[model samples]
Target: MPKLRVVSYNVRGLKDDRAALGEVIRDLAPDVLFAQEAPRRFRWRHKCAELARSGGMLYASGGLPGLGNAILVSMRVTVEEAWGLRYPLTPGRHLRGAAFARCSVAKVPFLAVGTHLATDDTERPAQAALLAATIREAGGTTIFGGDINETEGGSAWRTLADTRTDAGATNQTPTFSVTNPSRRIDALFADKTCTVTSYSVIDTPAVRRASDHFPIYAEITL
Candidate 1:
């Protein structure tokens, strides 16, 4: 069996202390990283690559096409396919989408999907539905990570939860507004194809200085 460490974080467009963000990422040391609000315009690719480099990982997929969602992988994983998806846009709302990569860790294959959803309560369900459908269709073991923009039990959260097991169910600690954390808006979900051995929230000085939301990750066996 192959076990992997998957991390999810909302980088706040890397507008904060990037070095601090890098430090947190380096410490967590993810095999697969799902980044939200990654640079979306103006040499976005370079910025995404730089982010991966800073974490000592490879830029696997996503960026502008994923509407700022991205996936970065450490050298241990071998990427086979990579792509992005954009959801139906609602007028006057920020664009929403997902990043996907089908990869193998120590020869065990799995899918990694990273995303961020709209903050508007009414807008998230549809996006969630699409995301759930895509995950179901993706097949095999999966590690889903993202900032859902709402806490658990919300419609969007439920939609996706119904489609997979919430890795954080056992320890639902908050991940937002790092300095004054109050919500668990970020998450990592694992499909039945794998087993989540542990879930964690990495909160440290670097995390607070890195972005508005703290980083969350899960260790799973496939």
Candidate 2:
């Protein structure tokens, strides 16, 4: 089995240090980057392209329609199919969504999804359920990553954990409030068919300045 390095990050809509963020991502050298809070306004694609280029990657999927969710892949991966999905809006609440891609690394295929759930306690569960269904429909080996906004054992977290392997189960490193770090809201989940070899919370200086949430990195095999 080949090992793939995957990272999930919330870039805070590129509102922070872009150069620092790129450097952190480049240094991490992930095969697949599942990003949330990416640029979604005017020239969003251009911004995303520039970020990907800076990190030695190419845009895979998700941007505007995903409401900030996006995915970037290294040269080693070929994106076979990709699309963005918008979750049903809860009037007056922020729009949340997900990005999905079927990619091949050295001709071995798998599904990757990125999302950011709503902050509302009541709304996040439904979003999680929707995300879980999307993963189930992804077929083959699947991996999902995002800023879930809820802690372990929470409803939204439990919804996904019930059917998938929580990548951070072995390493409960905190990933929120970069400076004061006190929670593990950012996470990665993979289908049982895939093996999560290692998982870590990237809390380096660059990562702390890149966004409000520390990135989660995982080494997986299918």
Top of the candidates by TM-score: 1
- Misplaced by over 4 Å in model 1 are none
lDDT string for model 1 (129-222, tens) is 9988987788777888999999998999998888577989988788888878899999898887678999999888888889999899889888
In model 2, which range of ten residues has the least summed lDDT? 131-140
User: Backbone clashes in each candidate structure, one number apiece?
Assistant: 0, 0
Pairs of colliding residues, candidate 2: none
lDDT of 2 by residue, 183-203 (tens): 899889888888999988887
Best by lDDT: 1
Candidate 2: which stretches are off by over 4 Å? none
Model 1 TM-score? 0.97
